[model samples]
Target: MVKMFLDFVGDKFSASNPIPVPDNDPLDDCSAISHGTHVAGIIAANAIGISQPGFIPDVPFLGVAPEATLGAC
Candidate 1:
């Protein structure tokens, strides 16, 4: 049930995005290292029933609805 605002692109303000979010102000990029990507994973990432290296669980990692599909965006 989570939809992360990982990449924010607006004229006024950008939320530490990877690509350039053009505007009057600066890009305001982050150095936290894949923070947005991590959050994006939490929102809607799928495990694909694989065994990842770092995680202990069999599924490795999952979102709220890992294999679910939502018609509406």
Candidate 2:
């Protein structure tokens, strides 16, 4: 499992002063381009009856922390 800590400094940090996060597009091929999405999936896939027919059986590809939250940086 991975843990993160976010610290806010300066007097500018306040409830009224929200940070602006710019919108971004996801990579077209998450599996091909980066392992980030795959790692995230491993940390959050539901593993509900999905399987690889030829390779494995019964056990689903569940994540370490299925209920964990996700965020982009």
Q: Which is the leading candidate under TM-score? A: 2
Task: Assess each prediction's global lDDT (C-alpha) against the native.
Answer: 0.53, 0.57
lDDT tens per residue, model 1, 1-73: 4333333453434355546555443334454587756665677677767776777766556697666543212
Q: Clashing residue pairs in candidate 2, if any?
A: none
Q: How many pairs collide in each candidate, listed in order?
A: 0, 0
Give the poorly placed runs of model 1, Cα more than 4 Å off. Answer: 1-32, 65-73
**lDDT tens string, model 2, 8-67?**
333343478766332232212223466777678877887768776694778666688888
Q: What does candidate 2 score on TM?
A: 0.43
